[model samples]
Target: MTANPTATEPTLLSLPAPDEWPHWMGARGDAQLAEARRLVDDLKAQRPSEARQVLRVWNDAQTALSNAASIASLFSEVHPDRDVRERAENLMQDVQKLDTDLGLDTELFAVFADLDDTDLDADASRVLEHTLRDFRRSGVDRDEATRARLRELSEQAILLSQEFSKNIREDVRSIRVRPEQLAGMPQDWVEAHPVDEEGLVTVTTDYPDVIPFRTFAHDADARRELVTQFLTIAWPANDAVLQKLFAVRREHASLLGYATWADYDAEVKMIGAGQAIGEFIDRITALSGERAERDKAVLLERLQQDRPDATDIDGADATYYAELVRKEQHAVDAQRVRTYFPFEAVRQGLLDVTGRLFGLEWTPVSQEAAGTWHADVATYDVARDGERIGRIHLDLHPRDGKYKHAAQFDLVRGVRGVQLPEGVLVCNFNRGLMEHDEVVTLFHEFGHLVHHVVGGDQEWVRFSGVATEWDFVEAPSQMLEEWAWDADVLATFARNEAGETIPADLVAAMREADDFGKGYDARTQMFYAALSYDFHVHETPDLTERLRELMGRYSVFPYIAGTHMQCHFGHLDGYSSAYYTYMWSLVIAKDMFSAFDRNDLFDPEVARAYRDKVLAQGGRRDAADLVADFLGRPYTFDAYAAWLAE
Candidate 1:
């Protein structure tokens, strides 16, 4: 029963209170923080005979605290106001410390500690099991001295992560280029970038600018300069932060009796050990090296033919040369393809595909009073058979102080009778039409929004949302990327401003061209995953060697001298040792797609099974089980291997 229950539907709950941005965030955060504390106190004060009731209160408090922290932290990451960001950061610190305190609270742990695990249902049992696990992990079972030290380490680790992200967010580096340097770029993009007083155009490292300049700019020196600015983003400042952050993680993991941070994180993921992750990376290296080298030689041949002065290519030369090779050899120019897939069309295509497959509809609603942080933000009501399933927010453009990457933020996670699930998909793409790959990226991120909000709707916050083991979290979204390649789906959304649909022949041509550079892309990710893994295994991260070594082995091109990619590699901030998850999740994603392809690409039966079993289930069950249930078979790497072979 909601506070404002209607006769028609109880689940059609009231909108969020205070109901607007800025004010609502702080007020809601503070109020929820208070309520959560009250709830926790109530739980601790309860008698052991009232275990069920106490557990209920604990669950409520868990959700409340989560909501409070989310509101505060969202602003800290995406708010344009620095003052709001600073205050939100402090608020997050306070909330996190409170969380640590509660997790370590002996009385809090004792509330449901003695309950017979067999007495509860599967969901409740899992929730209780997780609750106690978190408590134990927080040093609830340790002595007072050890508990204090653990708290200190938790604070330090979190604060360091916050700082690391802050640096990247504040990194507003840009390169000014002459109009001559931007020849062959898309028209809409060229028009968007107005020249300054000196007649030079400013190109930020935003994907919209960097990707275009690298993919279209014929000038090697210009692309090289832009790549340099991009590679060194927030350097020296971020460099020192990353170094200390490594030591803190090592200490934090060591205190937990783990040899490395990789070990600690792996304890909860689908893959069991740090060694297993390494072996996975090594397996990919073995499978991909020959193909990646062949692709590199092709690019090297182009480089030598075009720029006789260059014996080999560098990181700067990779994108530009690859684009050149793509055009000359495959008759596929990414910029040319972008003309067909505008942002609106691509977005509509995603909506269309989801509507068909999931038996759903999306209606645009004014979220103005909802206090959208930006004018570009749009809210949509997601419905199935005219009953609202949930809401989704799309913040699809780049702006200052926004999270500088493409991701889905589960702003409000679904919990039966408490609150509705809402998510925002944030990405930095051209305000105009996107390249084929950019469309794929959008579909991928939105896939996350759906997975986060719809897939994980359990009553308990701890049991809800995309809590799947980290390595498997990307699978659903990765599966969505396959939709981008489907000719039927592409025809639906791949339209120009004139409303001419993309030709089927072109789609086939583009698909063929797509695989030409995929080997290099795989190798690049392997480099990143390997580098991230090494950062954790050592006492101190010799990022210099790791970058050089991995770049040599996994990169399709040679590295540039005096340039450090790690300084700007924000993966070090949060992903840390888990960068391998991209490839890991990709394998599962490909497997899931293969199952879908075996039926129809837009098969309603497949979509329903996926939603009920995989997406909607969230982390309620093991990811492997969810996948198996959907596929009607056990998991295998065969689909991924087959895709790579093609």
Candidate 2:
């Protein structure tokens, strides 16, 4: 790929340089909004006889706005320059408001309302159906005052959500400890954090530092200190932010005839309503309870070795003690296992694994050619049978202002004969050696990237790239994590500096050790899921009390007083009332994985069938239909049940 570009070309594909972001964002954003509004006016004046013609214009306008919005949104999270990031954040709110305004346009809604959906293809019909539903949800039929109020609330919600995330992203808390406090930490990790002139190591709550610290460091007090700081991220700042957000959302939902935000949020998801969310949490909790207790007992037993009077394991000690059990009982030494996985190797291995499975190839694209925001970001062109299909960018390290967690963000939606899709994977992992869990996380996020690329080649932008129901979006990614656990899979890519592949027995032990934490993990997810659901369903929300009640009810660890876990829970803003999606998606993921032959991780027949049936379907079919198309039956909780029981 060439880096050179004609300076006069639009800056959308090749993102503007940091200094040019504000000007480019403002100019391009206005162009998109003005064009969309003009298109809506044109459509109102001259209704096309053919519905497809109307839809084509509708899709194009929406797509233009979406592309601009996606860029602004992504840059807000990953841009290193604060001024650029701030500009992006503000632009995103404006773009969101403009989009919401378009959705509420009565005249525009009527144009779609009158479209004859008969004799249309699946993708076109699906797009029409969703558009009509969305318009109603946007209050298109409401009175002028009501519509104006909805718009106001929508803008408020977007701004508040941004503030919530911004608070967490900017607030990087840390604790200092002596070298002795890092006794059980990986040597590489300890070396990476050199002692300052004060002779103390600084550990921040960034994922690269905090996760390993919690999982390995021996000093309980230090672990407690770090964990407490980690949990308190964006605390009091987010408290008010969350309060205003909930108020805005509550009013918005009420105006829309929804009883609560939870009800409104779940209407379009696989999970139907707030009540069902509670049932789901309860059902999963029951399934994992017995095993969770056994795990707690084992962890507490390990804890008592250090403190004879220790009664229970707290959040700070959970991962530390769990590692002790894994090494002693399952022969899975996490620190030893990490030696085989460096970030670069894991990165290439990930491409190789997915490429083999999907009959695709990935070729590196230079940063300049890709017009990336940072040097650390790497780009790849995806192809099948020599025909380029899509592209992906990987941003895999921690920085002061970067997003604190891993996720896949869509930069472009591949509309066949229009534009090819592009997705970005933003994560935080150690640059050299990586934890096994980090490897799995890498695989998981890439799964979303793969879905976006493979599923993207759709006739309409609406049906392109991981556009499935929100709750089902994580299944493909979660299922891909299974590959990371396979011994053969690990042997292919996980080699140490000495070039020794991980032993099959070691992978086996790792898998067994992995099973040990499932119950606790599942229960912890339940706690978050409960908190997510509880916060939205009620008329009045006491954020702290709700967080405390849910944590105590479902978590293996007791809630630390004065700590506001919800403040740091970024999903509360993104997923809103549906953080249960992770668990819900995992149930589907486990079920989907059962179709694979365990011995052949790269079975072409199974791989191709899945790629065509599931990934290629995108949002054209219902998620359940897509799952059934591959599995030859509706997905069930059986596989998930069996997994939890393991």
The backbone clash count of each candidate, in order, is: 4, 0
- What are the models' TM-scores? 0.95, 0.97
Residue runs of model 2 more than 4 Å from their true location after superposition: 1-12, 17-19
Whole-model lDDT per candidate: 0.78, 0.88
What is residue 9's positional error in candidate 2, in angstroms?
Answer: 17
Candidate 2 structure quality by residue, lDDT tens digits, 257-352: 999999999999999887788999999999999999898999999889889998877888888889899999998898899999999999999999
Q: Name every residue pair that clashes in candidate 2.
A: none
| Candidate that scores best on TM-score | 2
- Please, what are the lDDT tens digits per residue for candidate 1 over residues 334-423? 776888987887787789897787777888887544546667878887877787767787888888887788888767776766666777
Q: Ten-residue segment with the worst summed lDDT in candidate 1? A: 1-10
Candidate 1: regions farther than 4 A off: 1-22
